[model samples]
Target: MADYQQIFQVSRNQAIKDVKEGVFELSRSAVIFYPKEGSFDCVARPWLTEAGSRSARGIWEIEFNHKLLRYIYGLTNQFTTYSLRDCGSLRNPRTIRLYESLAQFKSSGLWVTTHAWLNDRFLLPESQQKNLAELKRSFLDPALKQINEKTPLLAKYSIDDSGKFLFSIIDKQNPV
Candidate 1:
């Protein structure tokens, strides 16, 4: 008997292969916050899901809607799909599960990138490094009064700062 993981992989693999071969288009639209652009755009793509929801324990379940699958298919037809994970050590166990789950996919198309990750903490000067740590703490500190109480726009998506989202674009293929 096949496990749910195996079943999901089988179905997802076939979908990826079929789309890659140009049998049909796969596409979906997502409501994502783009902090750099300072705008929320309906990004159309082949498949979009909050990563690791399936493999994670507790309340988080992978939210897969048919609309997203279709859009993902269509988007894959045009541009390739890339996968990214949160940077640094796995602070959250649920996120770790998500990372591990995505790691097993057979598709060669997906490339791993670091999303909202501060690069090279060691590289910073001693004073600057201290500042960064303090900054991170300050951003995470709720007691500090902030303008955007709901969503603080921080530089580079630091939790210690008020940032919506942080994205590093490598290998840009025709910005959408």
Candidate 2:
């Protein structure tokens, strides 16, 4: 098996704290490229194990149906690879999901999606924001801030003339 090294930002200390306090919610999403369904949930299990004498560390293991894993890792051409650490560092689930989704288009450095898409994928309530501007102010900006500051990835977005969001990823090798 090939070793995959995608790190999530939750530190050992934080993980231990969360685990012990029973405050952790482990969530995973598998994005499907060409499909009737775009994404599906996967199970995550987090626990603490001894690292050394009088020391312990957190471990998070994900469980996926073999078919799903095969489809995601084997068959999908459109997929995002992100550090779990970065995702964990994000306070909002929407922000984390956005990061993972956008990371798929890092090579292009650009992604365009509609407000409706965001509303659907992030599970934003219809009563939450009345307009795009309000949505951007309340949700998008804060999420972008966290993604830029906490992760290796950086993002910026604009509302196009057609009212679609045009998001651009800053190239890590040549940041502006």
lDDT of each: 0.33, 0.65
Q: Summarize candidate 1's per-residue lDDT along 65-124 as a digit string, tens digits.
A: 565566556866665333322212334333333333233321332323232332231232
All candidates: TM-score: 0.18, 0.60
For model 2, how does the per-residue alpha-carbon lDDT over 5-82 read when each residue is reduced to its tens digit? 224345566545655443223233333344455474543332222222222424434444445555546635655565
Alpha-carbon deviation at 48 in model 1, angstroms: 9.5
Task: Please report the TM-score between candidate 2 and the true structure.
Answer: 0.60
The best candidate by TM-score is 2
Top lDDT model: 2
Superposed by TM-score, candidate 1 places the C-alpha of residue 24 at a distance from the truth, in angstroms, of 31
Error of 1 at 93 (Å): 23
